[model samples]
Target: MPPIRTFTAALGLAAMTATLLVSAAEAAPRNRYVQVQGADGRGYVASRNAHRTSSSFTANRSIQTNGGYGLNRNRSAAYGEGSYSGSSQTVFNSGRSINRSASVHDNGDGTASYQRTVTGSEGRSRSVSGSVPYTPPQ
Candidate 1:
């Protein structure tokens, strides 16, 4: 009877230990990543990189006109506009990731416009870069 009691105690201890181990494993967080496709529409090497782009323009005009009352008047007008478009992709040897952004602004007397875009990718480790192609704008 004593041996039976000891065996039961040992079995219960083992079951509890197994449960704790499984729960601990499930509680652990996993590392994640993303990747993006290239201009050719193909997957890139495994890598994690952020992409960006920007463009802007400005114009100004100044003129002098003589009024019918023999009075001289000066007129000045200035206009400016800017826009941007870009995307980002993060990849790991195990998987892929991607992110994208775009913006547009019109000022003064220009037409109103807006744009939004999102891009994604999946591929190997060689695709992401640390600079240049993935350099973010200030």
Candidate 2:
């Protein structure tokens, strides 16, 4: 084939391959698990699973100790169309927990509105909401 035709074909193949690679990377979630044991018979297990795309992500993690102490947490977030939102919760085996959530929205005038809330183990909750001028990093 002519040099021009060959170059075009190579370029097309490269583009297709890049697209496939990106798609495959985005389609699979990453996960990890680990366990450790001590000579004294104390051990702990931990695991985490996370999935992410260009604009959104979610993740969860948990750990348990042999002494009946454990913690688990989950979080997720997304951003699009000038808005973002996220929330998370963490719990322990001792009946204590904490929860939090937040959201922000662009006001279309160089400002964004935000609201956030947090709750403690005793079920007491507090919230703060306001707007602020936003300037993204250079």
Note the Cα lDDT for every prediction shown. 0.28, 0.72
Model 2 stretches with alpha carbons more than 4 Å out: 1-27, 136-138
Q: State the weakest 10-residue window (summed lDDT) of model 2.
A: 12-21
| Predictions: Cα RMSD each | 31.5, 15.1
Prediction 2 global C-alpha lDDT: 0.72
Candidate 2 lDDT over residue span 15-119, tens digit each: 322332334368579999999999888999999999876567689999999998999999987665656677889999998999988677667787666667889
lDDT of 1 at 110: 32
Predicted structure 2, TM vs. truth: 0.75
Residue-level lDDT of model 1, residues 53-72, one tens digit each, is: 12221122222122211111
lDDT of 1 at 4: 42
Predicted structure 1, TM vs. truth: 0.24
